[model samples]
Target: MFWTGPLVTALILQFISLGGGQNNDPDVLLESSFPPAEPSLMNLNAICLHGSGRARYPASFFPPSGYAYARRAGKAVNRLEAWFSQCCYEEGAKGHGQILCCAKQAWEAALSHFCTEEFSTMTMAHECCQQRGEDRWNCFAKQAPNPSYQSLPGYLAPEVPPDRIVFTWDPYTC
Candidate 1:
């Protein structure tokens, strides 16, 4: 279990590297490599779950701007994976600023994935209708598909070791 984190991260980085130097920009190459699904499931936040079944952060806190970005640029799959890896890592870290920085980068990268016109249209299509801002975003993320386990032909899913995948959010947080 202890070794799974590095292993999974290595596997994903390896997979991403296999594309060669087709495009210098990792973001562009990633977008082109994995096209968006119809209606798009990329807007979901990838939260890390501890063994005790507690979430590292409030599940509904972050924005789905990442998903919106991926969809518009036609790179939903890879972008989603990036967010998942980052958030999952944050779960094991202790610094608040670092975690927030990662989350911010995740959102910004997704937002800047493509042109403005594309971003606006895609975002509007998926805008949270009933729930207010954060609530709506949370619902979207919660309902969004988990890309970590998303079935893709010819692609191996990450092996989440039981113990490593589960842990108390903070053993000392009374």
Candidate 2:
């Protein structure tokens, strides 16, 4: 309980900085006066995820809102997804095994994603989960630790809603 205040403050500061699209309302004035992107879908997803995660997971332990943590996690997930997508695109571009470069990129991106500060230990814990590959996310899910699995009031599970909305993150430890 003592730790909750600081964490909530941190989250709130992050939430405001990210400019949560006004309940996702497009008409809201920009709090930070930063311009929005036009064609970058990834950027848009990143923004939305940051806001959504903050809105949904404003627990006492984790910062209530933060672009720093949210953006970091979001980018890691995005990079991992992009790498996997690139592998498919490469498969289409040439033929299976022809795009070794893309395959390498995918593997490396997956590794980098796993190595992020938030997920490194968890990735190490989940020996079977690769940064990419068919069962990667599933494997990571299996490695989630104790409190995360407790089904407590504010705990977030590795299983995010919208099953299609997969993440490359370990469950929040705190």
Stretches off by above 4 angstroms in model 2 are: 1-67, 90-108, 119-174
The worst-scoring run of ten residues by lDDT in candidate 1 lies at 50-59
- Model 1 scores a TM of 0.30
TM per prediction: 0.30, 0.27
Candidate 1 backbone clash number:
5
User: Count of backbone clashes for each model?
Assistant: 5, 2
After best superposition, candidate 2 residue 108: deviation in angstroms? 6.1
Segments of candidate 1 deviating more than 4 angstroms: 1-74, 86-119, 122-124, 129-132, 147-154, 157-174
52-142: candidate 1 lDDT, tens digit per residue: 2111111121233343443343333334334545544745544544444454444334433433335356345334334554564454444
- Model 2 per-residue lDDT tens digits across residues 47-152: 2233223222222223345434433333433444343344444234253333333433443444444445445443332243334564554444333221011112
Q: Using lDDT as the measure, which candidate wins?
A: 1
lDDT, residue 128, candidate 1: 31
